[model samples]
Target: MNIRKTVARVAGVGAVATAALGLFSTGAANADTFIPLPGGEITQTLSDGTVVTIKLVGESANISGSMGATPVHRNAWVSASAQVQISGDTSATGGKIFPGYVVGCQVTIDGGNVNGGASGGVSWDNSGNATPSASANSGANLTLGPGQAKSFYVLDQEVPDDYGNESHKTRNKFTGNSGSVTWSDETIGLNGCAGYAQARSFVSVEVETDNVISWVTLWGQPFSLG
Candidate 1:
């Protein structure tokens, strides 16, 4: 049947401390599995004495086993909030929040940070100051075979640029001491993978201060996409 789904977004309302699981459908044979995830947090101090903290909260997922009634098709809905905090006397000004996910088909994606890059399911840097890679897509719909994986951002905001031209952005820009972005019911439709699949969340932030500019990223626990 070639079932397809579209991604949805909603404005964030800060971080939520409590989360729980729920069901999607009442049918016994085709009911979706709801999972409440324990999101993650990270704190890093920049060389210029600026502090950056990133958090992923209120994460959950609803998974459908067979989207198109075929073994090669799967789909899921994910929700989460990405929050950033900047502090220090360096006059840390503003930053950008890039929230995304990596999906793997029959491949292990628990390798942690991949040389401080976000390519080929490698994840963010463990040192907390690696520059973010520019290899992420802006959509959630994806396709992969066994031993393959891909990463994509959650935001596709359209706005006017400096020249008044239409611009598409994948990251939320925030100014001041704190900023946050939230999304609900984002769709992830996969195809061509007949084996087990998995997905993990990531929050990458770019911090800019009067003295220096740096990046900090936080990775979430991986979960199945059955």
Candidate 2:
């Protein structure tokens, strides 16, 4: 249950200036399409009576067509804020929050497949037990073919381990009733895919109690990558 916390702050005026530069910087080669997304929220109560709430706010993506100057490549920059709140008795000290995204190539992530299997390695089961695959990578630069998808964490925090060695983690651990993580202009580079693609955000929190441990996940609306 060891995790690191990283916070980034951006002033309103600075953000506006950055956007202006990105829009008027170049003609078509650097023409980035800014998309404002409607983030989502969810709440779940664990079996041990611990209530966990997750929210994704200020979601957005700026897509630039074919950074490789070829049809088989795509690139985008994403931003979002994931907030978590935990409430229960004394046993519910706190939890760990893991936030990431799933990118799919010609694959639908909004719903289940025809066979009710996981869509692009993500499960949105109705039993309030949604979870992402453990195969997610830490790097957003990825390669995929048709009918393929991959997941990656937004955080790559570097810290020291118990033995004073360098270590990396993708989650933020909190010991109170609330915690949050936010990222801005994170890169999502895709290669080897010539068709339409999509990306979705997820926040999974691991709640630890004296008697039981559980997880609750909240999924954001999926958006196109191309």
Candidate 3:
């Protein structure tokens, strides 16, 4: 059997298998099967009764690999989106910074029988900033098994950026704007490395007001890579 084709086939099957096993079930009747990410909505209430909501609409991935020589290389392109809204009684006099939304993907690699592991992810934040920023992180010196398996992160709704930068501070005490924030077709890429790869998307929020710096993951899905 062609290792490349076989690996690719397994990657496709992995997405379906994950969904069939209820791993991708988000209690949404209209959940998508082709995308390897979570499909649904989430809502959270802040200390001041501010309601933060997020939703994952859809996601997709493209993955390929080459094993012609030693130290194979695999690359992937992942994309996803979400809808974010903040309403209810928001603070108007407190020094609170609301980071509205974040979109990105995570990858995990498991080399079958080789006892090897590597992981990484990339994401962008639309945290009330005019110009959003993107970032990525991964392990070093990765090695995979003969038939390793990888996972993709399709949608994670609640992720925080590295720091509570001024640009990411979407809402402040002065402008207690309560409305909708949407990120569409946001994309990130991963290159090099080998073994099986999987990816998914995520949405998140970082509240840096009242000494509360917390992040929450609202939605997520998984896909396969070569």
Looking at model 1, the pairs that clash are none
Q: Which of the two, 1 or 2, has more TM-score?
A: 1
Model 2 vs. true fold: TM: 0.78
Two-way lDDT contest, 2 vs 3, winner: 2
Ten contiguous residues with the weakest lDDT in model 1: 18-27
Error of 2 at 194 (Å): 0.9
**Residues 100-132, candidate 1, lDDT per residue (tens digit)?**
777777777665532223354224334322233
Q: Each candidate: what lDDT?
A: 0.62, 0.60, 0.32
Between prediction 1 and prediction 3, which has the larger lDDT?
1
Q: Which sections of candidate 1 miss by over 4 Å?
A: 1-29, 114-136
- Model 1: what TM-score? 0.79
C-alpha lDDT (0 to 100) for residue 202 of candidate 3: 36
Per-residue CA lDDT of candidate 3, range 1-226, in tens? 1110000101110000011001111112222234444456666666556555555555454333322222344333343444455666754222222222111123232221111222223222332111112432211222333433222232233335578433322222222333223333333333333333444333334433442333444434444543
Worst 10 residues of 3 by lDDT: 12-21
Model 2 CA lDDT for position 140:
68
RMSD of each candidate? 9.4, 7.9, 15.0
Q: Which candidate has the top score in TM-score?
A: 1
